[model samples]
Target: MNNQQFQTPIEYLKGVGLSRADVLKKELQIYNFEDLLKHFPYKYIDRTRFYKVREIQPDMPYVQVLARLTQKEIIGEKRTKRLIAQAHDDTGTIELVWFQGIKWVEKMLVPGKVYVLFGKPGFFNNKAQMAHPEMELYIPGAQQKGNLTLQPAYNSTEKLKQFTLDSKGLQKLIAGLLEQTAKDIHENLPDYIRNRYKLAGRQESYRNIHFPNDANQLNEARYRLKFEELFFLQLKLLRNKLLRTQKFKGNIFESVGDYFNEFYHHKLPFALTNSQKRVLKEIRLDTQRGVQMNRLLQGDVGSGKTVVALMSMLIAIDNGFQTCIMAPTEILANQHYQTIKSLVGEGFIEVALLTGSVPNKARKVIHQKLEDGTLNILIGTHALIEDKVQYKNLGLVVIDEQHRFGVEQRAKLWRKNIIPPHILVMTATPIPRTLAMTMYGDLDISVIDELPAGRKPIQTVHFYEAQRLRMFGFMKDEIAKGRQIYVVYPLIKESEKLDLKNLMDGTEIMSREFPLPKYRISIVHGKLKPAEKEFEMQRFVKGETQIMVATTVIEVGVNIPNASVMIVENAERFGLSQLHQLRGRVGRGAEQSFCILMSNEKLSHDGRIRLNTMVKTNNGFEIAEIDMQLRGPGNIEGTQQSGVLDLKVADLTTDQEILQQARNLVIEIFEKDPQLAAPENQILNLAFQAKNAGLSWDKIS
Candidate 1:
């Protein structure tokens, strides 16, 4: 349709009045005619066959029957009143009942007339009955005369249904609008794209999606729509990437100077893995390029991401520029500071930690050092972005657990320097390929697929309640060997009270079993004060405690090389990603580590899949793929925070091939015509501009 016509208000549609339009907007977010057209049906039903009255079974799910209305009456009084009608055919009769809107039904029902009834069948007082059946006057030969064999089913709410704007009502309104606007519907994709992919025309797809002639047409319509949705999303992300690369310039690190070399050669703790080396080369290449680098570094937990980040930072220092690392939590910031400080050794390079807990006296010193360009590296939590904090010639920014920080917060760091620093976002959580492409598509991705040498893969096992004693014995043996253990309970927000009770009860049981001075246990949870939590964590870190019992609050930061065991209680309550992260708490030391998943005997289908998947593999990427399939894309750890996966038709879990194809096509288009200056791409330029008209990340400048 023409642009103005497409943007016409929904209230002006054929069947939608002011009241109905309000309901439509509130119920489904339909504001304009284009939105009404794009609201495709989620389900389709075949209406070719009709069941006989006597053949109706109580267990049947929604059946259609052609029968004659014989008699009707009202039952009960006041609020309990309901309309009951009997419909009979050649075989027998069935009862149709409606609890509400009795007046509307009574006026519509005509005795001794044939009607088509559709609803779920159930037994009431040992007789078959249908409640809230959809009724239509029977018309012979209508099916052969262009009536849709496949009927669409739209989603509706009770509030909408009260206004006669239910699924059927929506269908009628859409059909009326399509009859007038079908021919005016515009083709969004260019001719070459439609021909190469054998995609249906936009008009045909929209028509078939709402009312299909048959199953094949319906499938074709769905495929075209899904591909289109994914293609445009990929196009937007890739275009943003292209524009940013062309527009922004970065401070170049021309040499791998003495700082990097010293740390890489003499002060190295262990040999760098081949994967780490390869990723470092990528970062080296990116920093040397003139364009600003926005890259995502994905590595499984304990995969030596920190070393790579530190080396990259050293490159910045070598180029005479300051660097900073922003972490999501104070605990993680402290961990990074201690690790980097020890690795840097004494008096080689100046490093400082700036977190909220840092006192004003020490903070003043850090600020002064940063401004005077004496501090080579600074690491902190969100406090690094404070207005009081300023840096001289900041060239590289390393964000740890980047998803935990909002886009605006990360943008604040860019304002620190006239030239935005090269960004290196590191995450221990492995993201599925499709997700990474959609959510972080604007950023180049580098994956460290292999673990560092000498670190053993954590052996995982599942234990039932009956086997608790055996598991405890195993824990006792590990503790006796001078290794620490973590006992984590599920602390979901909805069940915090019950989970806390479980934690306290489990702790009491452990005290009773191990008992007295021979065993020591430290407890940490979200409810504890920061001082209390830090004190308990330090006891375990220092080996003063044999066990640390807590909730998933320790999922990210706490790192204890001496801890060799992770026992997750009620593991079935946790998602696959969380379970994997909890499992990563161990396997850091030279000794082999074990993760024991404890759940009850009875397990749900999804819960069984989660636990079994954990037992079968320790590959974080594999676990992440399965997690996406099980929980869908939006629910993954950082996806919601990205705000990019607002998908209506594309399912990332099942549509990987489509997503990849779309990304490849977008790259090809950029290669051929970066600005869409080609005459054949005029339609694409218009469509892209129309779809993306607001201020996005790429538009920040």
Candidate 2:
């Protein structure tokens, strides 16, 4: 259809008035004709098949039968009232009942009249019946003439149903729309793409998607639509990357100076793994290229990403530029500050920490040093992005746990320098390949898959509640060995619905079991104030407390090398990624480390799979892949807000092949027509613009 016609509001449609249009928009977000057209069916039923009354089985999904009503009855009083009718065919009779709309159903049911019935069959009192079955008057020799194999089913809500806009009503509106505008639908993909993919015309695809004549046509229609969706998504991401590389000039760090060399040769704590070396090379190459580097660094917990980020910062400093690291939380910011400070020593290079809690007196000094270019490296939480915080020559920005920050916050960091600074985003939560490609497709990705040397792998084990005494004994033994332990509970307080073990009750039990002066336990949770939590955390970090009992608040920043045991209570309540992060709290020392997963006996199928997977492997990527399959991409920890996975048809887990093909095709298209200025490619450019008009990120580098 022409652009104006497709954008026409639904209230102008034949069957939809103002009230119905409002419901459509509120319920399904269908504002215009194009949106209604793109609303594909969730499932379909075979319309050609008709079943005998006797053939109606309780196990049948949905059956259609031609029958006549012989008797009608209304039973029960108000609210619980129901309308029942006996429908009979040549073989036998079955009852049809409606608990809702009883008065209307009684008027619609006519005795001794043939009707078409379709619904799921169930057994009640040893007899087959259908509840709230769809019914229509049947006429002999009046069926539509075509290869009608399937009838589409659309999703509807109770609010829409009240306005008679359920699946059947939506089907009628869509049918009317197609009859008027099917031929007017315009082709969006270029001729070359259509020819390469052997795709059907856009009009035919939309037609078959809603009302398919055969299975082959429906399959082809689905593929064409899925391909188009993925193709455009890739095109947008690749175009953004191209624009950034071409338009933005980055500060070049030409050489590695004395700071890098000194840290590498004399002051380094451990030998760098090959994977770490490889990632450093990648970052080094990007910084020297003179193109603004937007890169994502993915690694498992305790994978030494902080060291690589520090080394990259050193390169920026070598080139006479300032650098900063932005973290999501104050605790994590302090952790990074302490680690970097100890590694760099007191006199080698100047480093400072800025957070919300910094006093005004200290803040003035930091702001002065930053403006004068004396602060070589500054690390802080979101305070780094405040309006007053200015840098002399901010060249490299390393964002820790980048996903926790929003796009606008990162953009603020970019605007701090005259030219956008080189960005290195670090995340310990490993993302699956498909997710990384789609969500952060504009950024180059480098993964550190290997752990550092001399660090032993954490041994993981699962235990049922019946083994509580045994698990407690193991904890006691570990504590007696001068190793600290973390006992993580899922909830801070008791949840009546979840029946999970809370920190309060668990702490009480622990105090009773281990008792008084022999053991000390520190407690922290989300409800605690920052200062209060820090106080408890410090007790554990200093080894004054042998056990730290807390919630998932300890999932990220607290790093105590002496802690050798992680006990997760009610482990089934946590996702795999959270469990993995909690497990990473231990195993930092030279001694052996253990992660004990404690759950009840009756674990759900998904919960069992999650716990079993944790017990099976330590590979973060493997766990992420399984988690994506189980929870899907939308529910993954940091991906829900990306909007890239707001896909209608393409499944990230199953449609990897299609996504890859679309990306490759995007590359080829750009190579041939970089600006999409060619006449044949104008349609593609226009479609892209129409789809992403006001989204600033789509156009910005």
Candidate 3:
């Protein structure tokens, strides 16, 4: 036994030489001995019992038997080939075809060898056929029905197969590794913990996942491992949270009296919603606290998040300090500016906007004002954090659409002050709890659940494009009633190809569809330069264009309350959350708003779910939940997104209890041994370090 780490994978183990090892590594990401033990099956075929051919039908997805390969042949070109074969039992003979596997069948076939065959029986050419069924060579008296029980189907890759690392090659290598290392499995969990949870030792858990003799064993293995993964994940989050809270000191500004009076007395164009008022109180309390305030302000679209943010900024300014708001896009930054400039009045506050496009001189002035404390509040995109734009007495940091920026970028804002600024982050994206825990566990959360008075909920409808004429007619009628319309399209062109067709196609179709010049129409998409896109978006926002036909690029977010209708040309292409966010653009005003999802007739189940979800409700949280459920567990871990969860085995959808159990356990552990240094928790600290180093499976379960 060796203590060295083998992160390479299963196929590259000592006994697994270049030939067979090549296959496993390529077909699977197995380059070390341990990977084989953990390479669980994607699915299982219960071959413990065999079925009679007479018992099989078109409806039966599973069938088993002893059969002989009577014949095998290949057809089609090299790129598109098919393997035709025949299998027979006493009841009857059936065709077994494997598309694109002709060569394997040809090499492995023998004239009269009885073997085990398993696959679905289906009708092709009005006869029975089993395409690309799993096959194993017959052994004398091999259970008679051979492979009659649960069978494992390991996932593989083409690169491994290229090295002749077929399924059998993988099975053999795994067997070799198991024989060598199976007995060496160590129990890292304490006895008391295992007994409390009724879990098996670590060794049994690993083996059961690989070669479980029965379903019960597999269940036990899954539970223990998943628990370990989730528990560690939650534990890591708690540790990070404790470290942050204990070490960081917030810029506490108490008695928000001056700020509140200045805004509430003579300013504040509209009365704040109760929810907004509540959130502001929370923010005020948070900023008054000693530790740095890492709070998330969650609200639905037009839920007064910005106003609440502004009031908090007022608190910082009233305390004779400055704050900065960072948005992901220029349009959103400018939109915030427009709202503040419109509502906050001119002289009471000195506000400036900084973006990448600001002129050199203008930027220099803004930077100087910021450094000298002349600037009270600044709103802009990433330009707010550029090396030159230093802050004076920076007390609060407000990040809008916080998800758009990375943790590193946000941290930079916090670090601008001697003590990290009291952080108040805002998001229009109503993320679900499962996702929130994984992403926002490091911060305190405050949600603004109420909408302002006169705010209207968007009326959503799902329909196929075949009903386009009727939908357009309805839009026309709405437009005729002194309202505007947005017809959004999907982008089919890359940045390289000039999508004249996208602009021309949408413009022409929309113009002709709605009686052209009778209704003013404009087009917008990503292909347009920032200036041009802004021009078209401005036109639509101002109601200068009665109908706007554009691509999903308009999803770049131009908030238009006057536009009462949103018609996504091919809604099926959008995720449920995206569709919901698009819908959020409208329904911000007092007027009734409508979202017409005009998707193509051919919609995938997920696509239909997306549209149906939109039709079901305007709740962004509900839509985000649906999206997470549909996307499954492993997928949400993209470059910036997936890292948020950082879970390995425990699934957010299925293992929520385990997540809670981990959280509760950590709380208990911390209560007793805050430093994780007690004898019972000593090994745990080491194990936690090992696990965290191996996989960042902590912080997000």
lDDT of 3: 0.75
Clashing pairs in 1: 1-186
What lDDT, from 0 to 1, does candidate 1 have? 0.89
TM-score of candidate 2 against the unseen true structure = 0.93
Could you tally the backbone clashes for each prediction?
Answer: 1, 3, 19
For model 1 the local lDDT of residue 166 reads: 85
Candidate models: Cα lDDT each: 0.89, 0.90, 0.75
**lDDT (10s digit) by residue, model 2, range 1-701:** 34788889999999999999999999999999988997889998776678998887888888888899899999999987889899989998888999998888899889999988888889888777999998888878887432136788899999999999999899999999999888888899988889998998988999999998778888899888889988898999989898878888999899999989999999988999998999999999999899999889999999999999999999899999999999999999999999999888889998999999999999999999999999999999999999999999999999998778887888899899998899999999999999888888888999999989988999999999999999999989998899999999988888888899999999999999878799999999999999999999999999999999999999999889999999999999999999999999898889999999999999999999999999999999999999999999889988776667888767898888888989999999899998999999999999888887776752223
Candidate 2 colliding pairs: 1-184, 1-185, 1-186
TM-score of each: 0.92, 0.93, 0.87
Output candidate 3 Cα RMSD: 4.5
- Tell me, by lDDT, which candidate is best: 2
Please give the distance, in angstroms, between residue 299's alpha carbon in candidate 2 and its true position after superposition. 0.4
* Model 3, runs deviating above 4 Å: 1-3, 8-11, 15-38, 59-62, 66-116, 119-149, 166-168, 183-185, 492-503, 514-517, 633-642, 693-701
lDDT of 3 at 362: 92
Which candidate order results from sorting by TM-score in descending order? Answer: 2, 1, 3
Residue-level lDDT tens digits of model 1 in 333-398: 998999899899899999999998999999999999999999999999999999999998899999
